[model samples]
Target: MVRLQNPVLKKELKLRFRSFKSFSAIIFYLLTLLVFTVGFFLVVTDFKGKGFIGPEMNVVLFTMLTFVQLSLVLFMTPGLTAGAISTEREKQTLNILLTTSQTSWQIIFGKLTSSISYLLLLLLAGMPISSVVFLFGGISPSDFVLTYAYMIVILIALASIGILMSTLIRKTIVAMITTYGIMLFLTVMTAFFVFVTLSVQTGFDGSELGGQKPFSYFFMAINPLIHMASVIYPEVSESALTVTSMDLPLWVTHISFYVIITVLCLWIATKNIRVNMK
Candidate 1:
């Protein structure tokens, strides 16, 4: 949590909590997750037609729930953060921030922290929905915790992108749209490119990591979904997602890529703000 002394963070939090949308967000998230969980159980088990959910089915349920949670956060976080700076500009308060005592980095981070606070709240509120998996007997506490850790990392990464776009675009709507497009590129387009490349190389042969094709692996490392898959299935097959001769797991590279992305985006956004302040 950012210190309350951060005036920007304090102000933003106050504004978000006072707004009706914030309350609506909590209700919407819980209801959506509850509906999905129940719907998945009913459909998968044929309305409990097949009794006794074995460990295998529990694993599937866990995977589904994890991805669903990831999806909800993914869709919501960009909308929250896309206006981080642009909205301030639109309100003519960006200059007001500059005249304050905080540094550029502090201001940007304050915006980011405030934006994500609600998302974190939603994650906490939805835990009971996710915890239902434990009643079966497949997903462990470690897996549950790790899944959340990955979500937070991805959320921060995506929010950083939103912050960068908001800083660069100067319009909330454009920033929001561009942020969504970039996220789509990072997830969908990367997978599509990999599929196409693998298909062309082997005339649609099975996707396998062979030879010294680091570039192909590089693409995989940048996609956040890869990291999620790695966490979901810790015993993932090496040949299915390895970087040929690379010694480390693919997920490590994926996390590293996002970390770099976060740092780089924050730096660039802060630099842009400072330049404008002069």
Candidate 2:
């Protein structure tokens, strides 16, 4: 059974890698990163004697670059997974797979693993670029680990959501659109809610609300961008002088919880495939 699934998985991955869609996306993402990095380098070079590219500056720059990469991953992962199932259906190949002995979980896992492989490849390709920030110093290995962990969690969450949408929708186009729409809603709408709640909870007074409970604190825990931000700019907290603050610990918990949720979502997708396969 494993042997049987291997061919299908390999074929899908090969096709995906060879296709113009994946190639174009990979090129576009890399170009964007290069552009940003060059621009940042130019700006820093302008401040040559002012200690602008010091240790702390390197740390900050690396953090910012990693955050941007994470955001792009979150945005693009849905595109990778959204059409996994729906594309099979569109190509009229899903029925052929359903007739095989492979179980629903196997099929779902194969598709998901294949899709994730591409995203992982793109990420690994950026490692060299990411390492450039290390030359200036101030960026610790622990910080890199934390950033990568947050990014993995976010990618899994987005991919699971995409797979769920793919399982529910019959058409590839519809699935893709729905997947992006849901992610956008989750990110933007949730942030808006947090902003409003925070404003109201703090009474919207001009004075700073020091030590006040963070509005959208719960949502922030789940929001991937917020999680990345917390990991990157951990010093900027809701309150000052609190060494053991809410950023790292809270986001760590959030990452673990969301990873679990993503697994559950994949399970849901597998069950969905079992029911929908005819």
Candidate 3:
């Protein structure tokens, strides 16, 4: 096995830990989860008793919480990764790093991985809260596994997008804005396309017009949020709110494609760095 040297990973992790950005993000997410869980418990308890919430309600709450968490990840991931490389260039540190024995790919991965580690830690911190939801009775162990796995895939995809933007842009501000713009485009535009497609197909019929079909299937396969929502609540497939449906098999295919794309982006970034160095 090839051991990766990542001095920057340790340094960046320490820096991120000490910074308010990481601290605030983790604290904010924890507090939000706590408030939601407490409010949910209170509503259920007030309505009847512990049994009132039931297993289905618990599952619903867990699924909702997972959705909210994924949204947070989507919004914050670009912030973490968009400046990783461009910021180094801005600070005139790229030459120093290039002079070292560390390969460009290693540098890129180290920065990307280190940034993601902080977010993953925050997600893991919420695991106990998620488990507590299980205590109330709706979610299964399989649900937890699927939810976490989806989160991991989402993080990788977002980080790759950010890193690609970082490598392409020289200024940190431009990179940040561009990264976020792309994220918004991906999440919002794809959803809009799905909606428009469905509308044109069924004329707002009650039946789901998208999913495992031609155009709809292609977009649905790529949208992480859509894939996860479908997996958690299959009933959403029949709802007007559901723009697309995605099964576990579709999720796996999407994740595989995203991973391959990320690898390609990393390779390109490495090549860019090497060419610039030369």
Candidate 4:
């Protein structure tokens, strides 16, 4: 429990909230979402000649906002956490920090959670703007809940990756770039790989290793966007989606993978910190 009560977390939170930049960023972030939502709504409604855009409109808006939020989180998370440790080391504060009462795990957890907390705050701030989806009549409370929960899982994975990169790299810039590189590889490259594989399989014999959609879908599960898309897509059956060989929602596999990666990254970061402390 004491490890959870990390001084680093408290300090980071205090400094973050006290800064005008954080407030401004949150405001700007929400405003940006608002503008996009309104712009999309205007275009759809106006072009349709004042007719109801139907339930599909709500799905479209929800999906667009989900992707937008995912992009923001993916891009912003590294910058927030990638400097968490390297910056301290760069400032020659690592030894000082190491000598404190906090253990390496505590320090790592603190920095990780503090960074994520800020990101979570930004996401929650935009919640009201996203809630406009409710007015359109396609999305439900469960959808919002699951989507936001999935987002938190994504944030944790990204933040952990950033923290691990920060701990391993001595330079903040390198750490930041490396973090983004890994994030991009996961977010973009995986999708491309999956798309290519599916396309090739479809073009060849209309069969993927013997007519299995789940096999290709496994690659889709590797990408968070795909999981989110499946969850957000109006046509996808939520209650009936089981993994190829398991009795669980396909998104469950993605969640488990993310959780495992998050834990591994954090564990490695703690180990790195311990090594540095010596």
**Model 4 TM:** 0.89
- Tens-digit lDDT string for candidate 3 (1-278): 33655787878888998998778889899998888887788787884646466777888788778887888888889988999999999999888988888887788888998988988998998888778876777566887888888788878878988888898889988988998887787678777877667666773556644444445655666677777876787654444233444344556567787888788878878778655533
- Top candidate by TM-score: 1
C-alpha RMSD (angstroms) for model 2: 3.6
lDDT of each: 0.83, 0.75, 0.78, 0.83
Q: After superposition, how far is residue 181 of candidate 1 from its true place, in Å?
A: 0.9
Model 2: per-residue Cα lDDT over 1-278, one tens digit each? 65565655777788889899888888888887887787787777873534357887787689678977987897888878999888888898888998788788778878887888888888877877888887888887888877876677677778888888898899878988988887886677767876776666553455435553444565666666666676767654333124222344565567677778798889889888755435
For model 3, what is the C-alpha lDDT against the true structure? 0.78
Residue-wise C-alpha lDDT for candidate 1, range 1-278, written one tens digit per residue: 54336888888899998999999989999998888888877887789656678889889888888888888888888899999899889999888878878888889988999888888998999999889999989788999999999899889999999999999988999999999998989889987876665565552355654566665666666776766877878655265455344566677787898899999999999999755533
* Residue 259 Cα positional deviation in candidate 4, in Å, after optimal superposition: 0.8
Candidate 1: stretches off by over 4 Å: 1-4, 48-50, 203-210, 235-237, 242-245, 275-278
Error of 2 at 231 (Å): 0.9
* Per-model RMSD to reference: 2.7, 3.6, 3.6, 3.0
Poorly placed runs, candidate 3 (over 4 Å): 1-3, 46-51, 203-212, 235-248
Candidate with better TM-score, 2 vs 3:
3
Error of 2 at 92 (Å): 2.0
Q: How many backbone clashes does candidate 2 have?
A: 0
Between candidates 2 and 3, the lDDT winner: 3
List TM-score per model, in order. Answer: 0.91, 0.85, 0.86, 0.89
